[model samples]
Target chain A: MPENTQEGFIDQQKVLDNEEYSIKNTQSIIQKAVDWFRARSMFVLAYGTGCGAIEMPPIFTSRYDIERLGVVGVATPRQADILIVSGYCSYKTLKRVIRSYEQMNEPKYVIGLGSCTINGGMYWDSYNTIKKLDEYLPVDMYINGCMPRPEALIEGFVKLQDNIRNAKSEAGYIQYRENNAFYRANQEKIFGKNTTPTFEENFAGMNQ
Target chain B: MFNFAMTPLGNLFFGLTLIVFASLLLIKNERRDLPLHILLFASLGVIFYASDLITLFVGWEIMSWSSYFIIAKSARIETLQKYIIFNLAAGFALLGAIVLIVAFAGTTLYGEIDFGKVPEALRVPITLLLFVTIAIKSGIMPFHYWVVDTYEESDHIFSAILSAIISKAGIFLFIVIFSQIIGYRYLHGSLFDILAWLGVITSIVATFKAISQEELKRLLAYSSIAQIGYIVTVLALLEGSGIEAGLYHTIIHTLVKLLLFVNIASIIYITGKTKFSQLGNLLYDYPALFILLLIGIIALAGMPPLGGFNSKFLIYTTLLEKKKALLLVAVMFSSASAFLYCYKLIYGIYLGQASGDKEGYRELPMSFYIPQFIAAIILVLLGILPSLGIALFNPILGSLGFEVSSYSSLFELHTAFASFNGGVLMGLFGLVFALILLLVTSMRSKAVKVRDRYDISYCGETPDPQNNLHYGYGMGQELRRISFIRVILENSTATYWEHISKLSGDSSVMVKKLYSLGTQYIGLFILLFFTILLFLGVR
Candidate 1:
């Protein structure tokens, strides 16, 4: 039941309800615009970790033309919105890849781009390679193949774009922010004390 | 005869004055060298004001030696030797040109130079001599070997002046000698065409060289070379607007270098480090300096809403007006590539994760901020009021005998071919910046500040603070992998200079052997001297 309480003969409940509704509407509209732009323009910093990088050129160049979908390759993480981990990450490459990912600005996404990244593929028995890309970086989607074809890569991008627009799932960045300790602990198991700088978040609860 | 004149004082002087004042205020530690800096300033004044080549040369020598002594105060023996050798060579070149002028024209007065009287055979050599002098002093391309070491090894404040003011002496000489004394008619020949090409190649190569440097100040040194290269290319245009455009850029470069070098100096002073790898995440410690550097680089990159863009705009227009399409393309390419070094500079110093020990780091002295703030305000003002720079240069341009550039209005800076309203541009930029900033902030419920400097996103792996994550040293290292850039990096003037040095050393050793007083050697010398004399007599 809705409370029909009045304060000093004024309809305070009605006023509060109206204000909340307006604020919510404004926030939602702004959010929608942000999400639309984020989906429309994606600057990917493609970290070629393994053989999967072989497939990237065909998709980005004249043949597949990723730019047609507003996805462009950038030189640095600072200007990029997407970090495409395009194969198996050795412990060494993982450090640099993570550094690159962290350097990118906010509203960023990660796409695990090959079977090696998904489950180590042929490198499953290897001493150097890591399995399960999401255990390290927050991966929004994974494209499975020994090396994904250009068509498969394009399809993955389209799906990622749709997911971004509809907000179908929790964004990887938010997930990482919420559970960074879990990621940090797993990363520490391999890298030990030599890991990249800690991603610090000052929690209000901690302050109290 | 020495003649001194200082009118049409120009944008260059205006900028020089600002930097001098800023440096004076900024210098707190080096009280003794204040006099030397002042003397350099006075000599530069003489060079700028001189009405004759003799007076200009005198000022140039004084400026060079005073700066040499200041550099020697802190520089290594090798660096000092390189500094003196290159500068002395430049000095002799200027002297040679002046002698040629006096012999040909029979006058030392700048305005009295009758280039028409100079024989066509001699004109090119004289101009070439003067161009060499300018190139060596300004550290243009192949002659730029001395600049990096001297800049890297010098006292930081002096480095600021060396780059900001001393380098401009070359541009001053070029303007006074080539554009005014030699006249455009003689310069329109193949000589000027070669100069234009040299400037283009120098800028392109230096841009890559700057990108490859690991040391912070060395990067700035190479950047200085590249910027001066553009000025050289424009000055080679020998057109009305080209000279004006050069002066405008000269002023902007002066301010930008002063701001950037001082910002680095402050960082160096605090940390006692000059390499990029040694410094990182300073933004948290010195946000103000970071902001100043950002402003400096924004202008240096020639982006709009800053004074740099106005000059760059004028330069492009001047090149376009002359229909130097390919030259324009090359210049544009060089300018476009400059963005990498500029990014590397700011990033190396301030951004990314903290890589160094933060303990014992003190705030930069109040004196350091003085220059940076002044430059920042001026850059912003010039961005909004670009015509102020043009208006400042108008009298100088008028005095130089070029037609004064006309603007559509006080707010719109106009060349013969193009025009832009700086005021409108600034207003639009401000409005858009505000809108975007507001939009970004309102979208967020609250900010998630990083918990620690080390807390960066690593692949599920924790980053050990011990591991170096700052990409400062390696930022542009990949550029060398490009085939064209690879060739450039592989072929350097080091080998050429090394060969010359070796040849000189070997000849000196042989001469020393001849001088050694063995009885047999003395008798042989006497015989050889008599033989040479007998041969001359017989002839």
Candidate 2:
């Protein structure tokens, strides 16, 4: 990581797929069974960040019937599994969304729902919305569209479920733990001293 | 003359409440007003054992005044005024009923004064007056404005007693007066119907009110009102099983409140915070208290394998037996919403994230755990063997002039429409619980335990310890947006009661002018008296 003294921030020159940052899950029979069930039953916390939220209702309702694929919407983060960041997240929304995501239990995933989450879509020049979702948090999967249709959303769910089942890539929650320092550094750059809690300052002594 | 008689209903409530009082004695709090607690309990005994209206009235007055003084010790002026005013009004109502009964029957003794001997028109008024007194004490709707304030302002330990045992004094009075004094034939009409409706409405409204409360004790206060509402509704059936169900529920509520309030008192004693927003994440530091509260909530929500479920089961069966589908549905709705507040009670104090500085908290004394464990164990035993409760109530039911409903065994409880075999229910619940526990433990190796509580999935940002992460305060705030709930939550009888108080205040001020010694005022009073006399003479 290169320090950018001019902006007092880290230079984001390296791709997120740095080999040193790769995370993996241990393969076992019980682990496979657990992952299969968890993949099937995804409780999505569909946080509507931008226009993409308009597309979620149809996917959840009779048109798509996402419930058939064992994906359901929950009211609280305590019971949620997958958090859907539905388009570009403003700094304010990002703070709350991060808070909601942290409240969720283990074995959780994040899905960057639209093109804005990829490169801030049309608002890349806006002062608020972050361009890359993965810079502040782990993005387990991303579906491409200005606003993904219900069909595309369902397809995204399918691909994510397949990834979860096969353990094909590092899970977002595991990466969050192993490379938390990097993510926290990026978050602090955007949020300054007001960033969410740091693991070292807040939680380090408590973990015995 | 001191005359005392024991009935099944009275014995059951008095004995169970005595158990609660005994449990209270186990707590070694600084503000344990031991003498007042004893006075309150002894007065309850007097009310329950009274064979005459005079003795009941005496006992009632003692109980009310003792509790008022206890509350006055730490309560604010406004809270004390509300408490005393309502209680005094209830005391007057009871006295008026006694006077009316004496005027008609020419005696105060229960065995001597027969409702049949009284004039037909006087019977309804007498019953209603007595009903009003009970309603006020039990904190029934419209008459319940004083309860939350009193509960909130009192010492937490005393709040437990007030909720657990004192409120039940009204139910005891109801059972004795309605069943034995007034008799069912006089009450098989619109009067009891009004009471039944009032009870259900109170529960529905109180359940919603309880959900919106941010203060822990105030929430429990509303919950107490709701639970007592169910008992009142059941008591209105004027049937053997209905009374039994009411008694059963009364016992369960007493135990649940005692356990919960004491557990909360322990938390408050340690942390010195009363609002849900001010407290959080004490589960690890006080894991035992957490489990105790969990048990309290489990029973309070009336889940299986606890005495709460047994009582609720009885209440449902009685309602169904009476063919009250609508009432049953309303009761179920209230029960369902109760889950939200019950979850809040546990989640607010223990789980989620620590909201404020918990460093100031210290270890709770062992005295707190003694009462909690006692209540928890009894609740479990009653859940496992409900027959014990029925057997105790059988003699009381027989004494209440109703045929004792027989159980097949020590563990089976049967009603006309349904039966609950406690042994079987307990066995099945235990078996399923054990299997799930075994299965979960077997897979424990595969499941990674996140060592850090703060190490939760956040979109990609870390969570600040200072940030308000515990949703305890906001848990039920959104319920206000629901149309039906909004209607109930927005409309309260407080304004009506306030108007009544203002009216009385104005009348008292006008009367006070009559005592003015000014010449003009005195001459005006004389002129009004002569004018009234002249008008009467002309007529």
Candidate 3:
């Protein structure tokens, strides 16, 4: 087999035409463009749960004016590309996060807020708190701080945009979807069992 | 030996092995309900002992996942999702920081990666990463969502372990980076002040939140956040005394939370009623248990003559010396709030109106009660003799190389505690209190009436048939007075997060428009691809 870095080897093998991007310089070039566009495409989801949520106001409205950078906040999961787990969750909130994540479409990203969501922060020992957020779903970025500073959050935004632009994720959403059943099952497992009348009715009727 | 992979490896391997063993020997077969806890503890322990960054991270991640599974196993999937989302967010942030640090540090080894070797620019970001991870785990304000829900929904004993042990991961990480690697000197001490407010505000908000909750588990959860706020506040101090106070609080909180959760366990098991609105009049059946609960609640409330008071005193003294006046006020306010909740806990569960007519409310298993019993006794013993727990914890602190305090003068309050003649004061106060109580009793007539329905929040209306009104009790009711405080603590951050999700959805929508006829997106992608190639060629 020819070395991947060597032109003679890869060209001769003609390994399924899908490998075309790997051999070309265009991928890097295209990435640069994506990043350029991503930098300007500033819309953010304000998924505040913890104290980190506190910093967003100054950043978005007055102090930092993240809006100047093209970042405006959104309101619903369906309309969002980024899901921020602003703080830690109990068994109860985890269910809603899953539902929200399910509602989000492709090319989605998740940003965690505050230290609590990171590893239960200080409540790491609390029997009610989950230690980390990533056990159940994918995360794209994390804004550090018990509640991250507005600057740090801005930094997080830039880093995410950079990742989005640079990632060689030209492949369709099929790969992302294949492993999502665990998420669905996880969502079902929690939602299916809530005894609250509102949810109970949904569980009984929605399954059919 | 404590390599990056090793820590997570230890946790992952041990977690699986224990789960297997629990399934085999403990339950002897298919899906025994027991393996859940053993797996949780084992995984958590291995993660704690993890030696390096990646391994520690991996172990931490896996343990978190497993614990989330345990909590979600309760079937309250909504809370589980919040739990999962919050944890994932923090985990990703930690990972981003770790990845960046590794990129700069050139290694993932826990000890080998020296911050000094890295470029000046990267150190603050790395410290921020570690700090954030710890803060999230610690349930510092804003980050404290998952703790309450998971605690409320999961098994009572599970909540106990979670509150007692797993939560320390945040402190462990804090110690790892804050005192150890970062040196707490970053950004010219500016960040410290922010962290300090983080603690103070969180304390105020969380305490208020705790006071307002009605459900036993939810109340416990908020209380848990308030306690964690104290710990974070101490860490923000960055002084030896402050660190000591924080560590001391950690130790006390660990004991107090364990006992409290165990007490909760006993109640949950016996009555199966989880909310304050549902439970009542348990003192008649379980006198011994009620006494234990009282002690636990007292200790948790930071009342005198208990372990809670000693630690609270230390924290209060430290804050005062640091001159964190607002925090001082917050601490006192939170304590006062504690009295209300603790009173509600007792009255609502054991002294208020009983919900059912069940004559046979049997006691929980003796095994289940053992933990609570041990916890309460220790709380009392530690309260009586703060030196005992302090002496024991000192060695652990020493081994961890934490600098101990020599500030005898700091704790000396409005007249030195040692010199103020505490014994004499106690005797005088006891006599005054007793005399006052005796006078009040003598003054009261035999026809003094105390009715159940007269409580103010409950006074508003009767139990309506259609919608059971949730009388905003505790901090919830109190929040109504301070509505303009921006005191909305629910995950309102999602409004913006969802907006971002929408943009991504919009991106997909745009792509769909490009290919709505089943070939738009694909064709556009192709057209865009070729257009770029041809344009570049033209250029």
Give DockQ per model, in order. 0.19, 0.13, 0.01
Residue B158 in model 3: shift from native, Å?
Answer: 1.2
- Per-residue lDDT tens digits of candidate 3, residues B433-495? 999989888862232222322211221122323332323233246555666434554433346
> What lDDT tens digits, residue by residue, belong to model 1 across residues A56-94?
899889999999999999887767899999999998988
At residue A99, candidate 3 shows an lDDT of 52
- For the predicted complex of model 2, DockQ is 0.13
Interface RMSD per candidate (angstroms): 6.4, 7.2, 18.5
Residue-level lDDT tens digits of model 3 in A35-135: 56655675566665555667767887887887776777777655566777777777666765655654454456777777777778888888776667765
TM-score of chain B of each: 0.94, 0.96, 0.78
Model 2 chain B TM at 0.96
Q: What share of the true interface contacts does each candidate keep?
A: 0.38, 0.14, 0.00
Error of 2 at B497 (Å): 2.0
- Tell me the fnat of candidate 1: 0.38
Runs with alpha carbons beyond 4 Å of true place in candidate 3:
A1-208, B1-32, B186-188, B396-402, B406-479, B482-539
How many clashes in each candidate? 15, 6, 96
The runs of at least 3 residues in candidate 2 whose Cα sits more than 4 Å from the true structure, single-residue gaps closed, are A1-208, B517-531, B534-539
Winner of 1 and 3 under lDDT: 1
Tens-place lDDT per residue, model 2, B370-455, is 87898899898898888777888888888878888788786777777877787888899889999999998887444434556776
Q: Which docking category, incorrect, acceptable, medium or high, applies to candidate 3? A: incorrect
